[model samples]
Target: MTTIDHAVVLGGSIAGLLSAAALAPRAHRITVVDRDPLPLEGPDAQVARRGVPQGDQIHHLLMRGQERIEELLPGIGDELLALGCEKYDDVADFSQFVDGAWRMRIQSDLKVTMFRRPLFEWAIRRRVLALSNVTVVKGMAVGLLASSDGARVSGAKVRGAPGGTLAADLVVDATGRGSRSPFWIEDLGYERPVERHVRIYMGYSTWTVRLPEGALPKGLAGISASASPANPFGVAIRPCGNGLHDVAAYGMAGHYPPDDLDAMAGFFEELDSPVIADVMKKAVPASEIVPYRMPGNQRRMWEDLPRRPENLVVVGDAVTSFNPIYGQGMTMAALGAGVLGDALAEAGTLDGLAETVQARLGPLAQVAWDLAVGADSVYPQAEYENVEPPSARDRDRARAQSAAQSAEGAVRVAMRATALYMDPAYLGSPVVQETIDRWLTSGHKPAPEVTDPTDPPDVTPGVVRAADLLEPATAAGRLAG
Candidate 1:
């Protein structure tokens, strides 16, 4: 196979880092450019920065995501686990409430680990920078540089650099959700890719709180309550490190979670279960509330464009941005990098590389896109364009199906738990589909063996006094006595 002399990668966060890793072996030199100064500190750094506005929010590295990252950067998982990140069976260790009922805690091999987004990115940045062929250049990419015939991107125009254009054999756009590749492509006299959007107007708030190690019972490291149209809100609490937990409350459409502590507590109290609310009342606040808003899920159809540059490709959130609530961003980014690596190995050179990689990326993202958009479309207030929204009847059917799937012995939970690591089509396997159908129609089945046999114990931490507290809801009344 032929090897490229040099390649350029835009953005230096998770996506850019992984892109560099994938290209390093095939290219003699690689330049990773980012507008934000790359963090040099290692994994334990807790610095929250603006480059990734959602850095402080609760982050879930799904089962598949963890495995993919480990494959790219070997021993990375053990390094993270050594830094106090908790690893456990996502099915057995987490207590989840979806479609209004708690999911049965059945033991499974699916594993997931919890860590802060900033810290995780920091770790990846360190590994990518360690590659001798990869050099991180700090600057913003103002535009793309096309070939003499204007049919391919030769490189990018770096703002405020010694030379106007940084030339390379290939240019990658990993600038994330705010990427301007489509506009740049248009200016280069090529057709812009069609785009799709699903407007959810989601607002979420997060807080980092401190609690004693093992403050709760054994075998429980995370708890979550999913949002539905009936409730329009949800909450998740997971352990980050050093006895610190990250709690996040979210609302869909116009029901935004408040930025104030007392008001935030009120939102938690309103969840179907008191587990998160009780933790909020007792846990000592370690950080102020940080709120984030996402306009919607968007996908740029680069694969559909009839005319495009042969040397340029987009990856990560730049191509497909999903609703962060589903935790698909990081995993999808890794998947894109893998596709790029495979395409390069096949082509033997940069000729016809961009189109091949971009086309392959679309299907890799479609699975996660379907899951996120399908789930979000059920809400009555969400708006979408260029896509068919789920009908009212469809929403009702979905809710009923979800409730049935949440019941004990259902295979759907296990299927979803492994979605990121396996093919999204696995959810449609006859075994899983038939299981859901039988549960819904027959209404009788043997229950799966429960990991936690006893009922949840009352572990309410006493409420503290504060004048700013939102009007008290019957807090104590919600918990078991």
Candidate 2:
């Protein structure tokens, strides 16, 4: 046997649990530490714990994130669907408008899960616990126990029963954005990690409703309004729930939704994207007008750190967190855990695992970082997060200004190109190459897709049933049934 004994995880959120899954098959025992008592399997109410306030926003599982979930947890996605989490194909259902055009591009067979953030995190946590080797315990983590050599972390000092300690061969930090690991390190006489934050002042007031459970008028569609002169707003109404709907209104920094109901209505009426306003204008809206805000796009430069605790690794938002508008945090964290697993499997020692994960994750981090920073740069007060130098490429902004300036069409092209490239390999595909050529006006093809504004999907589409790509997940639930 390989004989790796124990792995300890801090933070029981999405990143932590996913890391647990990656380590499950290899580690003999795993301990997950969190301040909140973990949620039991099945349905539950949302509870606020520590400082994680964004737990209520609409959390979307991007196509890439969904594929990772299926691979690691097997059938948990289906369990989510059966419990009322919504799963739908992106191209078919999403309403996208950018660069002055709508995209009617056919669905690329990508199924995304739209679920309550807490519910989604809970499902993954359950899977982590399902492993006989994993145990969930509630406690606060204070600091790392450093080896005398000062180059390695041996374990952690947690706030368990009056200052308890847990020893491990590997200690993973999935503790989220507010994580105090770095400060704790400095307290132990180490250099603090540097950060790059995209300055964006944003607040969101979200609302969710039960769309009559069985059928609806139209499929789900999302709309976005750009901050550029020709366009100044955006709205997205995506398919969600067991057959329900979620609608959220966002504004650039100070323009976001306010707490006053009357102001809320006016904001909705005048939102950048037209679709959300239309839905809110109708329907008996469900849920309260929940409000939340993320002040900055923060990233800690752990890769460049002069020294890092050998056995310690920080995954998830603790490393980087982007603006929610892009919906990339969850996905980024999942990919991070995947990287952690790969490092553990190959590395002979847990020593320096944190730095290794950071270096390996540099590419994914760059992709998400630029996309967010580019968008934030267009908004007022966005300059402060000066993490990336001003010379960075906002290809869409650059090309749109010089080459393609149509708000509706250009934005769609940008979104489409980016989505296709997420496959990474598709960048080399002939179809993708042609689209790029056409997009740059090679043959001047009419923009590939001009999608209609959509209504919500029906509850019984049977589209999400097992035969679908979501089959890996859907079938798991049916088997359990």
Candidate 3:
């Protein structure tokens, strides 16, 4: 095993904290640096801070991410719940409207824990700080310190208390989308990573509201309506604990949701489903309506560079930032840390660790980039280079698959892919294809409406009920048979 004397992680958010945790077992000492003076205790610790602009936004930990995080920091799920987080079934307690129809609800083991971004970060920050070898420094990382040959990073240059070139055996950048790593690397005579951008022009307006008891239909913990070209507006409402829910209205292609509360409610009213708008009628706004916008998805092709500093690796949004609408940012950050850990274990030394990890992270980031950008490509205004817009047939195929959510098997595969539990190729598997065929033959009827809040969910027509369908073994068995 290669012994790491010290590792310095830039940025103290989810990615930075998780990176520190990943380094704790191998490195003798790990220091996490961030611009914000991270709160250690009290109510302030659990709420949005100045550093994290999106801290007030809604965030959820996908089942896969939650599992990976639990592995990195055991009992974190329980701790989050103790701190007033809410865990709900991914399918059973959720409602979604897509492709001009309501999707059939099916019970599944996939769980999603909901919390504001700040609380989630705080939870991980607390756990990372608990490790005897890990400590956090209040500082802003400005550049990289390199060895005499400039072949490896020696430390980081910071701009606050104890600020200087903090020497380390390994340097990890988790500085997010605004990172200056590229310029710093270029300054060291290394090639700058190629950047890819997809212009989405997406906008979001969110509010934290206290819903009246039974505001949402019974058995439904959250509701969402996906945005499309036909109806460019969408709404997502999810529980954020303490009797509060985060309600967000989003639009794409310059059809930005209004910041005014009344106008935002009006925006929801335009969605395909009236459920969200109706519920908003009784929701008491607990916080100011917050608005955020994104230019598009951006990614740095670090692996494509012929050479990079050996002891440095960039993680999280610094590598690739997806459109926030997909909610893949935090999950991807956790997975990136896992990749970093894997690279460390495989390399058995710091030499060439950065290059190896960058190569591995490329494919991982491509998964999310493709998913987010593919969906965004549907809009004519979405701009990208060297990538063709999805053909009409492709669009039709996607729409058909979405409509196929009327079948339990189809819903299982689709939701699993959405949760990042399976490869998207599973969407084209024999089972999903067969299910889609069955759904198409059945006229693609929309899910029945439930007029009453306490009424049982309506089962869709031509449904295929298979309890073991979601299991990998069962899926493989079906493929073989």
Candidate 4:
């Protein structure tokens, strides 16, 4: 049986809440600490809290993430759907443009949920805090509390408290990309973990918009255009909920998207596809364009540390903060929660738990890390640390991967596997390899029917007011104000 009694989880974002869920069954009591106050009400009360600055950004549950979440909190999928989240085939209902071409969309089982990030996080947090054993404390965690011997983390030190130390049998740091785990561990007399960073200098400006009544052209639930070196700009437009769509414009290497709606339309004309631009030109803006900037992709190599606290482990963005443009953080967090549950079940004790769990979590992040970094390498000014520059061979491989995703047969399998969070190596399977090889040799030709082309759809700017799209209940919600 697990020896854990009370555990402390820092940062109550999606990651922290999920970590609490994973430990709640084994630990007699779990206290989740956050910089932002816990959401007492349901998803309706949820918004981009001060804790998650990017909470207002667009987000989705890739199929695998959807499954993992369902496993942790049964029927969450249904709850979200009933709450206005849209579920659709990832490829069939969504169009992804890469390498100046649209990915072949096909009917498949791979599906994802599109909803506001705050609502989803709220749903997960609500469920996690509902566990009788779990409690949430509002505060900012400053450091780790270590035993006198400096071998095991005994608790956490918050900025303000009855004293300052909140004791625990275990400490979980889910403080996200700005995590101070390395500094805290080093302060506790352990060596700092090595860090790897890939700088893309990414920027985002997202707006809530109202689309035409029935859906935009060919029933496409969403559209994404990946940024290339030549263009250096990207756009992602997806339906959030209540007939409102979240349109985000991003750029790589410091080419920030414009905040002005008209300028944004002009920015889209430079993209590979005019679909998003056309829609944006016609959609009614429901909210101001909110901008977010990320320095780059970063990962702390804690698993490589020779010595570490036995009763502590870091999870989620704290470990690997991937480029948010890929929408991998939430999914990776869910997977890490599952891995933590497995590690606990295997060890049955807190002894050496940090090392064992951190090691396993490293592999879980490798696939997403590689995908993000490899894809980001295409930009002109991409920077790297603790990683080598891409060679000609590396560039060729990246190009080939892009071509594979652009092809029909290969992309279907590759995309489905990726959406399901399968190993990136699966793209190297015999079937995928064969399809990619054939496409390469055949001069990169897509099928005759690349898409279900719809008639030139009518899009009229200011046709639908913001008041018409958003539910009155959300009037006092964060974005509404």
Candidate 5:
């Protein structure tokens, strides 16, 4: 265990509770400070705090993350499953049309648990608060307090009923996107961290339904991906308490799901596919449609900032947030806390924990970040286009817009090609669509069709059936007519 004395966490969301849980073993004392009074365990009551804006949404915790949580807080996943969080093999259990092409569910080591964000986090927070070394304090952290040298954060100054201050050996910011740690650091005379934004003009709105848990569609436990690029969408037959299933209708704002029953009907009718819309068709409304607007993905350059003060670090969405379409936020944050635990152990129970923590989280967070930007950068929305919008005037506007649309089309082609090219027998791949999505997201050279990979490298995309090796793919019905 690291010999650190006290670690103060500034947010009480999943990230905050998980951080406390991870650090509790190392720190002599850990306090989780939050602006709102987090909910208690009960099905009859669950209210969103003023602090947690998108608290009540159909959120999915990736299976890999559930594994991490099980490792950190044993039996936590099972406990969640018992508490209405439905489990399914996310990528492996469900076949996906990811890059394009209906991807067969290859038997892999990945799974996911679909749950309402508040209930899941509340469960974890309860477990965290149970730790003898941990405590949850109700207050809003306004700023940080540093040592005499001001080289490291000693604690935080919080605003509460009477306003107060709490000092600690280390300070972790678990606050979500609106975190002020960067500005606070600048005030402490350090270079402000840079930020990256991938604007997709996305919004998530959920409608509850009273479909019997057993009657829900098969393979309906998690998100069923949509194939349309213009409407890259997600549908969840999420399990809530008491046999309740939340048939969440999620889409980008320009094509947002409506709250009224008629609009709701129209919403599903317009989806790229009829699968999700059909499910919503039979579902009985348990509650009014809840609409929440969440804009572009914003990630702080916390890791890139050199000369970070001692006893100070940021974790969770404050550090980096990905496009929700990936359903990686909770899992990624849990993994981050797990890394923090391992880092504290490696730093040898010493004063350098803050610096080491960020280093460990960078690689993990970057994986999600790179994937999000690579996809979101290609969105067709006018505002989310590249950093530099067209400054040219006159008919050039139409020309540039047309060119952008063409590039976007090429992007989808590339994504589809990437999906198809991997299939050894899929006529042609590389040349036509490779990297089209990237080009669409980020203006680049026009995508051109290229020859398929060197005849056939050792590996191909489809499931390698025993029948495939001896004959052409047609025998397996994997090839086009």
Candidate 6:
């Protein structure tokens, strides 16, 4: 077996850290490079970083991603819980309004963890950094170091203090959507990866707030209203921790939410239901309102490249970035890391690993791409390149399936797909299609209107208040157990 003496990963976000973790067992040494001085201690440790522009937005740890991450860093679920992250049944705890009605909530085995993007990354960073073979370097990677023959990537070149060529047997680009891997590949005389874009013109505004007791209904962990062409406004409210929640409002097809607090409230008022607006009335803002815009969903078809440098692979948003509204970004990162781990185990060496991993990532990304872009394509104003939008019959079928969620069985199947627990193809199976068509033909009634509970139950069941969950000793203990 060829030994990996050193492996370098660029970008210290969830993808980068997870990549480093996946490499820890095989590589003798691993270095994670990022432009931000990743906070390791103090109050800033959990605060949003300047580098992650969407750090303040609401983020979800889907069931599939949670399982994969725990596999990579065992007991991370307990660590997050100990750090005050809230865990809830993905279906039962969530109130979803779509197709002009409330979706029936059916209890299922699927559980999801909710927290701010920064806190989740903070937790992962602490665990990855504690690995004996892993280290983090603060620097911006500018270019790839090519081998003398230019046949393979030798390492990366950073452009700041302690910056230079850091040699490695393997290099991974997890630098997110703005990754320079394409240009760097071109710089080495290789053709750039083909690109695809689905322009939805989506915009989001988020705020951190401490909700007054009883503001939200009992047993309800989140409230979401999906957007559509006719009604382009959407809103999601999810608990972060310690009574703080992230309230994010988004608009699609040029209907951007405002960043101003009052204007944002007005934006919320336009949703299908007034439940979110009512809760916002009692929310005390904990942080300034933050706004982010995603021009489109993009994918770089690296797997399609006929040839690529050895010892080089890309992961996470560098490979495919979805619309954040779907809450698939971090999960896709974790899934990509899993794919990388599987490729390494099977290859037993870095030879041909880059190509294998990239090819595998294509299908994995396509699943999410189809789901996200398929939803966006419903908007006639949405633009697309290199991909045709689904046919009208298909779109109508999809809408029927969504509207059929009032039936418990249909909702369970839909939730499983949403949680990424089942293959998206299952949704297209004859059994599922028949059920949806039957429900639609029978004129199934919409779920009853859901309102805030007059008496809210304690929503903090599995959470704990610890001094510092990131402390080395505590983190080590968590990992060990």
Highest lDDT, which number? 6
| lDDT agreement of model 4 with the native | 0.75
Worst 10 residues of 5 by lDDT: 450-459
Give one digit per residue, the lDDT tens place, for model 2 in 1-481.
1335988899888889899998888799999888877867434534434446777666666666676767788887788888787666665565445444443434344557777777677667766787899998788888888778667777788887244988878788899888888897887678988878876777666667654432333444433433342434445455556555666666565656675455666665654445555556564666677777778688888788887667778888998887786787888778888888788778776656678888877667666666566666665456564355444334333333222222223323344334322333323334433333445554323333332333322222222221322222332232210
- Give lDDT tens digits, candidate 6, residues 116-163: 788899999999998999887888999999987778999999866264
Return model 3's CA RMSD, one decimal: 3.5
For model 3, the superposed segments whose C-alpha errors exceed 4 Å read: 161-163, 393-404, 422-473, 476-481
Provide the lDDT at 145 for model 5: 90
Off by over 4 Å in 5: 41-45, 92-101, 106-109, 161-163, 212-229, 232-236, 239-242, 382-481
Clashes of each: 0, 29, 0, 0, 10, 0
lDDT of each residue in 275-377, candidate 5, tens digit only: 5565666678877767666677777766777787888878889988865655668877788788788888777555777778887777667655644554554
Q: What is the lDDT of residue 224 in candidate 3?
A: 82
Q: For residue 359, what is the lDDT in candidate 1?
A: 81
| lDDT tens per residue, model 4, 1-481 | 5757899999899888988888877999998888777766865457788768788887766667777878878899999888888777766676777665566555656667789888888888778888999987778899888889898888999875558779999999999998998899889898988999999998899889898865566677877777888888888888887788998899899988887776876798887777767777778899888888889899888889998878888999999987788778899898888778878888857898888889888876876777678778877698999988676545544445543333444544445335753354455445445554565566665444443222222221111122321232322221111
Residue 8, model 2, lDDT: 85
Candidate 3's TM-score reads 0.90
What's the lDDT for all of these models?
A: 0.73, 0.63, 0.78, 0.75, 0.61, 0.78
Estimate TM-scores for all models. Answer: 0.87, 0.81, 0.90, 0.88, 0.76, 0.89
- Residue 87 of model 3: what lDDT? 85
C-alpha positional error of residue 336 in candidate 5 after TM-score superposition, expressed in Å? 1.5
Task: Give candidates' CA RMSD values in order.
Answer: 9.6, 7.1, 3.5, 9.4, 9.4, 7.8
Better of 5 and 6 by lDDT: 6
Writing each residue's lDDT as its tens digit, candidate 3 over 28-114 gives 999999888778798788877787787777777766677778888989989889989888776677777776666667656667788
lDDT of 3 at 117: 84
